[model samples]
Target: MSWVHIARKDFADAGRSMMLWALTGLLILAVAGISVIPYLLASDGTTPGFEDGVGFLFSPIGLLIPIIGLVVGYQAIVSERESGSIRFLLGLPNTRRDVVLGKVIGRTGVVAIPTVIGFLVGAAVIVALYEGFAVVDYLGLLAFSLLMGLVYVAIAVGISASVSSRAKALAATLGFFVLFDFLWEFVAMAIYWTVEGSLPGFDGLPAWYLFIVRLSPGQSLSAISLTLIDFVGAEDIDLTAAGRVAGEVPFYLENWFAWVIVTLWIVVPLGIGYVRFKNAVLS
Candidate 1:
């Protein structure tokens, strides 16, 4: 009950944030553009329908939602602490858990709602142009995208709560963003390069290679999106023909497991941060 009030307050407050509005606009524009461009360029036959357009958005959404989630959550606690309003938050009959949970819920809404709406708008465009819509794909994309957003919101809010300063929180969150978003791929590739000589080309790479990619939250989200959305003009999840030929890469490499990975990301960070926030004395 108390968490609801806190979450409601934060949700209402987002209305005044020009930066959020701007980012939201950018997200919408990017999504809509991705959703509509192919139809515009298609010669009325070779091009696919709105379903394909929405599916096309999977990659971009997987990339952009984390940034939006970070923006929404990075300052959840530290900004309030810097402004000394976190004390005010704590003063209002709120426990550390309540504050943390409320912020996570509020920030999740901040990123997820806009994202789902953008995709829905794409669906509308598809319906109008194609005269039919893939409701399952539309809904699944929204559901998974929402889950992905919450996963990152949890991570960002956890970082915010665990840190003592806004700068440190921001740095940590951005570092996390980079770690999952870009660094993980590079690190995996480096490992692959170092070990490639021992194995045959690409297909001969071991299960541990896929394990390293699975370690990243972004990779997990992208992989989850693959399960929900049928992408057009995109190849199968197999990165190489050899991976396809490898005959069931590994259990962790499976699509359904990506959702499990996302769930872990949501829980683990929030748990760590909640413990830290519960123990720390809020000044």
Candidate 2:
């Protein structure tokens, strides 16, 4: 109940800031604006279908949403500590766990609200410009995007709670983005090379290799997205781990298990942060 109050107050404070509206504009641009690219780039006479828009949107949404989540949540708690307001926050019968949980909920709202608005705007544009508008599939993408947002927000907020300074939180969160988004593929490739004495090729990858690659938040969510979105010709291109593995796909590599991985990303970070914050000396 106290966490609920904290979440509400946190969200209300953010609602009054330009940051919230700025994020709304950015998401609108990311979703609606970027969605128009496929249509404009179409060389043939055929109008891009809803699937085309969704497919084209996947990469940018995957990239942008995580950064947005990190930016919004990285300062959620550390700012209070840096400004000496955390003492005030904790003085009001709020436990560190409540603060962390509430910050996750509040910052998640900051990301989700704009994301939902962006999808709504993008939906109108897609329906107007595309040939086949699949409402269900589009909604599925939105849901996946929101889940992705929640994951990154949890990560950034966890860092925020674990650290005492906003600078440290920012550095840690940015490092995470760079490592996961840019270098993760190379890390996976290196592992593959070390283990099998060869770089991983398109086909016949071992289950462990694929599992390592998918361990990153983006890859896990991307796997889950394959289930949510039925892209045109997706049958021909098997993006799932089943297509790459030589023998049988392990249970861990299944699409359903990606949800478990994503859930772990949220819970593990928050748990670690809570434990650290619990012991943090906040005089």
- Per-residue CA lDDT of candidate 1, range 178-246, in tens? 777888877887787788744334555567777776778877777777667666644745653226335
lDDT of each: 0.77, 0.92
- How would you encode candidate 2's per-residue C-alpha lDDT over 1-283 as one tens digit per residue? 6899999999999999999999999999999998899999987898977788888998899989999999999999999999988888899999899999999999999999999999999998898889888888988999999999999999999999999888899899989999988899899999889988988899898899999999999999989988898877889989888899989989999999999999999999999999999999987
Instruction: Provide the lowest-lDDT 10-residue window in model 1.
Output: 236-245
Position 42, candidate 2: lDDT: 89
Overlapping backbone residue pairs in candidate 2 total 0
Clash counts per candidate, in order, are 0, 0
TM-score of model 1 (CA atoms): 0.88
Q: Model 1 misses residue 52 by how many Å?
A: 3.2
The segments of candidate 2 whose C-alpha lies over 4 angstroms from its true place after superposition are 43-45
Question: Candidate 2: minimum summed lDDT over ten consecutive residues — where?
Answer: 43-52
